[model samples]
Target: MSASTEQPEHLRRSLSNRHLQLIALGGAIGTGLFMGSGKTISLAGPSILLVYLIIGVMLFFVMRAMGELLLSNLQYKSFIDFSTDLLGPWAGFFCGWTYWFCWIVTAIAEVIAIAAYVQFWLPHLAPWIPALLCVLLLLSLNLATVKMFGELEFWFALIKIVAIVALVVVGFALVAWGFHSPAGNKATLANLWNDGGLFPHGLSGFFAGFQIAVFAFVGIELVGTTAAETADPRRNLPKAINSIPVRIIIFYVLALAAIMAVTPWRLVEADKSPFVELFVLAGVPAAASLINFVVLTSATSSANSGMFSTSRMLYGLADEDHAPKPFARLSKAAVPSLGLLFSCFCLLLGAALIYLVPNLLTAFTLVTTLSAVLFMFVWSLILCAYMAYRRKRPQQHADSTYKMPGGVFMCWVCLAFFAFVLVLLCLQADTRAALLASPVWFVLLGIGYALKSRRAGKPDQAGS
Candidate 1:
């Protein structure tokens, strides 16, 4: 590689506290909460609230560990950087590539989702058009500058925040007024337990809820990735991470509680959005259209996040010689242009697949399931890295102002929780297939790592 190609330009620190906070907020709230929560409700009943609370609490620890590690060393770009330093190069290779692939798969799914959501309005339009256009739009915004990507996500996240807040507020009002639905069921807090109690589906149903609910929290660690571009992460990152619990209570718990209070758990359609269902029950004008637009932007926001994260992950990998050097090269805007384009190109192929595949929804389910499984792996690695940091850098942990609560003990707890979720995946045929198919990715990574290591050795041999 030439010196010019190895220019030391790095990710800019343009994202302010608001961007970090919203990005963190956006990561916490995913499309699954919008489109997939009904299935969770049907599977777990009112116990679904408990399921989300557990996941949120567990993931908050994961984020805290991640935040502490990142702040411990400002030179670290992401968790991948810390993982590589604390664990080994192999850890970095596997975590980096797997994370990159995870987002690629997620971005593709989001693209497909965007197309399907568009079809709700433009029934006659081809699915690929909107999917392709969505990718192009995100690519353009991300390529412009880091702040532009931040701004795009800021508004995208704002829309979701507004929509969710509206749902909760309206839902509470209906319950207060003792509003009755068209089905003659009164909207009240009793709806949460009136049917068959919170665990109406039993422990098995509660366990089943973990399978889908885990996916809702897939992007929760995304704030860690933005550490490089975030301005004053020391002050801002903690603020974002510490507020996670409150956000979860408001966004997931309160919002879902409101939904059930208005509609009842048994009444939520497993295949449809409870958010839209709640609005329809509330007699909102054009509720379907309104919720449809919110979900569309939600999907878009998720894809935008995937694009930004993947490029940065690739850039980080390239900086460590885990990927091609060109990926590390930045545009005039300090954006990882090549990696962004590469990820978008993969997304475009997903658009093409949407045109070709007859059963894209089924395929999408498998893809998302696989993504959820892999994300757990990444989260596990974060905890593992945290444990390693605790053992290897006790001084840093001791001196740090923002040490992870529960410390290494929480790491074990979080890891065990992920393992439990993985076991639950086996109970369902779809998730079981995804769980079983996950090894193929690792097998491929092992082979790639060995080859890269051997090739690295050859140059050293010649020089000696």
Candidate 2:
């Protein structure tokens, strides 16, 4: 490798407290809450709220472990950085690329979602056109500078935050004033239980909620990616992580609970956004038009986030020479231009798939499962890294100010919980297929590592 290519490219620390806070907010409130909540409510009734709480709690501990690991070593670019340091090179190789692949699948699905949402306003616009345009816009913003990414996310997250808060407040006011859903069902807190009760779907439905609710929490660990670009990682990172439980309660649980209360779970259309329906029930004029715009921005925000995170993951991989060196190149603006374009290229491939696939819906069923399974690989690695850190660096753990609670015990708990979620996923045939397909990723990565190791060793033999 040439010295120029070997030069360390530092990611600019342009993101401030507000940017970190909002990006953290954006990560937690995916379109799932705004949109997928309808399906969740339909399947599990009101128990979906508990489903969110359970997934959120397990993930919070994961974040805590991640926080402690990142803070313990300022040299760590992201959690995967520490994974390599604590575990081994192969662990880093597997985790880093797996994370990159995870986001690629996520970004592709979200861009397709953008196209779907665009149809609401432009009934004739092709899905690929909007998908392509959205990816390009995010690419340009990210290419400008890291702060541009931060500012865009700040506004995106603000929209979601304001929308959810409005839903909760208006929901309470309606309950107090006794407004009825358009269906003539009285809008009261009793709506949560008046129909068939919280567990109306039975134990089966309650567990079923986990299938989709887990997807809702997909990017919650996004704060970990911002570690390198954050202005104050030690302070900002801990603040962002410590607040996950609160965000889950407010942005997810309260938001869903309010939606179900305004319109009973039975009334929520299984395929439609309960958010738009909530306002329509309140007799808010143009409710569909208004919420459609919000959901549009919601999908755009998520796709934008996936773009930013994937580029960084590739940059980290390239820095380690596990990926092609071009990905490590930073433009004059200090952004990973090559990595951004490459990720965008993969997204374009997804666009092409959307254009050519006979049934886009069937394609996404496989994509979503692959996404969930790959993310589990990355998260489980983080827990394993934490266990390694605890055992190897007890002094560091003892001296750290932002220590993970419950010590190493929580690590096992989280791992067990993740395994259980995988079991739940396997029970469903569609997700089960993805679960099986996921091992192919590790198999491929292991093969690459073996080849790379052989090549690296040959150079030493030549030198001797």
Candidate 3:
């Protein structure tokens, strides 16, 4: 593509290598690792280790394919950008909008999490006050400039990274000294096997863990979204992607292993955060609230990320003429002002609904369920889009220095892996409900695409 054909970028390329690196960690180490790990351990026992490994390996391929694709065309902003040309305009429209919706649902969940978490500090405070305030503060930070967004994410991610490193260090000390947990379980490597062996729930339980583990990786593909606004996509993006193995090791694998070693997997609770549980263990004064503060910041961090990415996605959609024209317009600060405000409004509305709902728990579950289903669609789009890039641009592939490791073979493997996740989705009731309702979003997108194409006096284009 020539410069004449290149898409215009109004958003500033202000994010640096440090910003990108920490942003990757920020997105990866959110509520999923902090809160959801408890449930995963409860279901899969020590086998959750394998579950994280499998999902991380599969997603690494997905990111490898994405890194190659994004670097293949600097003109492309997000995965959806090239999907429009390589796949079809509809591919861009469907996946781009679906991604926006995914973040919206995720942001809502995080907002509710913030509200509930703040209650741990003030027992009688209204949920809506802190939730609305959190959204407004995050929105103001995002609206300032891309750099402000970067700064906010940097500090938030720093907290998470520091917390994880502390957890690993503290946990290892606990295990090395032979510290016994409050429940009388000894902190040792043997705890992994001493409690009914690794596969306590057998193969069935192992597969069941994927249902939750998959969503734990929802934002792992985030760097690909920063292609246009990143200072040096070639160097910084790959550095962030290359560190995935180490990240999985330290953040997910070792952290969980440390937790299980300190407190046996059998003693872990499904309903509570293992971090808080362990911090509040014997001889730790006020550690529970400290961990709770970390959890609150983690939730706020996730929502902050959702706000930043969702606005950019909307801007991409509008720049491509897939969305309203105003969304493409940028502020004097070179930010997508319209898109950012719109996303923030939707977040506030969603938060308000959650606050007013008769059953806040039910609302939170519904939002999470939808987020998982749509994130699956968005990730699959990345794989399918990579496949299309490979088939359609052979010369480009041959010229590229950073290519997917297995090439086309791994693309098929990743798709098959996703198909297997869908099967697991159906095996559970919450995920099953989400799988069934998954059609509603796609159907709406299909209708919207058809109408837009009709108005354009062109036939609807479909992706292979």
Candidate 4:
């Protein structure tokens, strides 16, 4: 197939249903769940499970709305395009740019996480070395071919799945068989509620957990981004998206329940990962090393997905004339070569920053909070796009096959929810510092957009 002059048809629908399913799973399950779950449990106690379920449901509906919009127009390759066409040029511009920023910030976090994970085995190595090497590896894989990216993600996701399944299985055996710990104590489900009674921290704790639990579901909407590249999107998209609820329940809720069952929630250390703790409690000496490797793969998978989605978003923007024409260029293998390289270059900044500031915890916290804040911006834009679709395209709404369940009402609700989360960020001192730092990022993007608009002799065509 020849590439289109206006909008390059570079992405081949080569991804199978299995690939789409696993991609969605990989996007949903990230290093956040592996490492951050301990903090969430500390905040909400056992009630964090409810927080995960709630955020998952809200995001599921959000994804459904996104899916309906994408399927309504086969030409829509990414949410940015749909937002631009349905909402306006400004919505598309803001959504596309913000989403790109989201991934870039997320990539930084993933790289930092990879360095931290590597420190488990190589404590003396400089963090920047692994961080730099990881960026190069993912960059090479992503620049190869879309199919290569899919295959790479498939295997990376498979590792995460197998690791989680193993943890859950071992946890169950320890709980059921009454396996004694090194301390001569038998494991049981009573650990979940015995110490603090599930919500020991009370309603405030449960509410506080929502602030972080929502972060775990940050990239779940990535399934829609793969629509243009998946073979038979109509069949595979729904199959991948429809299974989101189940995945949320099993991976987030059940996985947490299993961990809490085997080990008391209070005993779960905030500094250590729950997955690592599970193996240790189950009397596995190598559990820490094993879980560390799994988390490293998880971080790589996240960074890989971030690179893929960001490049496609840039490609879509270029097609709409919102980005430079060069970004629309494609290699023989149908990969957005320029966009991929651009994103990879942006990732290298993470390595440089790590070199300048060797404090891993400070770097990790800054990148992670920035990523979460930017993701919230992206989610809010999606809700805004849905609201715009309702206002401007009532006919499309009437003719649509699959519609967002609550229409404009729920759009407002979700937007409100997003705003609340932002406020919570301000309430927390560490997150507040990150949010304060975020404006500098927006300023840089705005300056670039302005310069590009002037060069093109257009009135900021980004969102129009």
RMSD of each: 3.0, 3.3, 3.4, 3.1
Off by over 4 Å in 3: 1-9, 459-464
**CA lDDT of each prediction against the hidden true structure:** 0.91, 0.86, 0.86, 0.83
**Over 4 Å off in model 4, which ranges?**
1-9, 359-364, 443-464
Candidate 1: where are CA atoms >4 Å away? 1-8, 458-464
> Can you list the residue pairs that collide in candidate 4?
89-463, 89-464, 90-463, 90-464, 93-463
| Full-model lDDT, candidate 2 | 0.86
Which numbered prediction scores highest in TM-score against the true structure?
A: 1
Highest lDDT against the true fold, candidate: 1
Arranged by lDDT with the best first, the candidates are 1, 2, 3, 4
What lDDT tens digits, residue by residue, belong to model 1 across residues 196-269?
99899899999999999999998999999999999999999999999999999999999999999998788889
lDDT, model 3: 0.86
Inter-residue clash pairs, candidate 1: none
- Clash counts for all predictions: 0, 0, 0, 5
* Candidate 2 residue spans exceeding 4 A from truth: 1-8, 458-464
Superior candidate under lDDT, 2 versus 4: 2
TM-score of each: 0.96, 0.95, 0.95, 0.92
Candidate 1 local distance difference test against the native: 0.91
